[model samples]
Structure formats: structure tokens, C-alpha cells
Target: MSVLTTKEIMDIIPHRHPFLLVDTIEELVPGVRAAGKKCVTYDEYYFRGHFPQEPVMPGVLIIEALAQVGAVCILSCEKFKGKTAYFGGINNCRFKKKVVPGDVLMLETELIKQKGPVAIARATATVDGKVAATAELTVAIG
Candidate 1:
């Protein structure tokens, strides 16, 4: 019914600082789609070593953020509340651009299919409304 702030999202997803990439979920329609934000910062732990001189958000983390958005979508469903949604797999994942500090990543995730306890979704991370990364993420309730 309402967008979830970072605090509310933290309560729903089991991710902590550094790994907690999604800063806020602006919109979520249970069992359908969700949109969120990840504000990149130079102070991030990974940035300290990701390339001291030239820090950049790793492509893998981008995919993970996307999947987490999907997870929020699934867990938003009443039945999966408080239940952990594990990443089953990622297919056709591609990084089209580099993500750096100060970039506000808009995570958009859409449910493509769901069967039993398995859910498949399409996700994308964008900066300045341009595609940064995309993938088909499979999640399972465990």
C-alpha cells in the first residue's frame, strides 16, 4: 500500500550494512513488481579495496541488488513474510555499464513467473534512467 523506507526494507530483508545495497523501496506491488534505490557511496567497505585508486561497484553486487529487489517483492506476499528467500540462480546476467560512487541506482524488478516455492523474475539496475545491469533471477522460499 505504501513505499518502504530503508528501515522498513531492512526489517523485511536480511541484509546488513555494506551488503545492504537497496537504500529504499519506492514502490512495491506484491506478487507483481517493485522498485527501489541504491545510493552508492565512496565510504562503502568494498570501495576501500575494490580498487583503492579507482573504486567501482562490482557487477556481481549490482545483480545481487536486483535480486534483492525481487526478494522484497516475493516476501511482500503475506505467505513468505519472515521467511528467507534464497537466490536459486541467475541467467543471462549482463553488465552494460559501470556503476560508481554517487550514482543512484534505480532497481526495477518484475515477476515473470512463479510455481510452487520457486519464483523467477526479471530485474534491472539503472542510473540516470539508463540501463546498467540486467538479469533473470530465480528465488526459492526455504
Candidate 2:
């Protein structure tokens, strides 16, 4: 229906501060697909320790960003409202480019399968229409 803001996401997922990778969800279709964004900045906490001399958003965080998008897809369910969605596992993850400060990452996710409380999703991160990273995320309603 409508896009979700950071506050709404905060209500659905338990992530906060540096751990919350997604800024806003642009589109959501519950059991089908979703899209979101995160604006990387030089002020991000991870960039400080990820590299002191040359700041680079860690590949793991990038995957986490994609997984967070998947989280949004699963939590779009009404039954899961006010519940915490945790990343159960990740598979087939690949990084094609390095994400740095000032990059606006676009996260896209599609629901692949689900069994009861667990769901699997395929996701990708892009910038300027180029793939930055991709992953298969598994989430559990907790």
C-alpha cells in the first residue's frame, strides 16, 4: 500500500542505531517483493573501525542491509505485527562492488519460499542501477 518510515520499521524489527541498516521502505508487497534504501555516510559507526585509513562499508553490513530488506518483506504480514524478525541464515551471498560513504544503497527483495514461521528470500543491493551485493536470506518470526 504505502511506504514505511524508520519509525514504523523500528516498530516491526528490533534493530536500532548502528545495527538498523535500512532507512525507509519504498515499496512493499508482503509475500511477493519489497524495496528499500539506506544512505551510507561518513559518520556511520562501522566505517570508523571497518577501516581507519580508507573507510569502506563492510561487506557483511551490506549483506545485513539486504537481509533487513527481506525482514521487511516477512514482517509485512499482519500476523507478525509487533513481532521481532530475526535473520535465521544467509545463503548464496556475493559482493560485486565496494560500498563507500555517500552511496545511496537500494535494497530489493523477493519472497522465495516459507514454512510456518520461517521464510526464505532472495535479495540484492544496488547503486546507480549496478549490483553491489546479493544474498539469499532466511528469517524467523520471533
Candidate 3:
């Protein structure tokens, strides 16, 4: 699949600015897998409070970004179109690096299993080819 702009991604999943962590979809395979990007900047909303002196992107938000991309991977399916994917659970999550300003975060999620409205995916977030976070995500389509 070709690259997807924020607007195009928005068409597939329901996430908005600030809360919408994905800036673009670099690669997509509808229901199979997807890779997204988020350019972390110094002006991001959470920077002010996360650390006034030295900003660091929160780990949970990184997980959320992963989820958003995973949502795109799952929700883009023909039968799941226009539906919302909610987080059923996150497992084996780990944070290996601190994501900060000027870092372009690369996120990828691959759906490993699905049964009806439930799906499971393995997700990873990276910065400059270094792993930042990884998790197994389970979501329910509604």
C-alpha cells in the first residue's frame, strides 16, 4: 500500500490531533499489517508538563500510538470499516529507549490472530532504527 496522509488515515481510524499520534501511514496492508510515523517535536503538548526542563514522551502515549496504528491495520478490513477498535489489553510491553524531541518514531503492528470482532497484534515502536517499545496488543472491534 502507498503512504497514507493523516486525513487518509483518519478515514480508516477515528483519532484526532493531540490524541492522534500517527502523522502518516508509511505502509499498510489493510488487515494484515501497517507501519506509521510520528515526528516528535519540542512543541508537542505533553512536553510542557512531562518535563519543563527536559521533555520526554510518555511510554503510555507510545503504546497509544502503537494502538492507533494497530487500529488502522485492523479497522481497514472490509468488514470492520467505520467501526472503532478499543483496547482489550496490552501484554508483554517493554520500554527500551526514551523518545524525545526531533525523533521520528516509526511504528509497526502486525495482526497475528483474529476471531470475529477480536484481534491480537504484535507492535513495535522505533526511533532511528533503535527499539523504543514493544507490546502485544489485543483489541475488540465495535
lDDT of each: 0.90, 0.88, 0.95
- Give per-residue CA lDDT, model 1, range 55-139, as digits (tens): 9999999999998889899999999999888999999998898899999999999999999889999999999989999999999
Best by TM-score: 3
lDDT of 3 by residue, 20-105 (tens): 99999999898999999999999999999999888999999999999999999998889999999999999999999999999999
Model 3 residue runs over 4 Å out of place are none
Cand. 3 TM to true fold: 0.97
Poorest stretch of ten by lDDT in candidate 1:
1-10
Q: Each model's TM-score, in the order given?
A: 0.96, 0.94, 0.97
- List, in order, the clash count of every candidate structure: 0, 0, 0
In candidate 2, the residue pairs with backbone N, CA or C atoms under 3 Å apart (3 or more residues apart, or in different chains) clash, namely none
What is the clash tally of candidate 2?
A: 0
Winner on TM-score between 1 and 2 is 1
Please tell me which model should have the higher lDDT, number 2 or number 3: 3
Candidate 1: residue 83 lDDT (0-100) = 85
> Rank order by lDDT, top first?
3, 1, 2
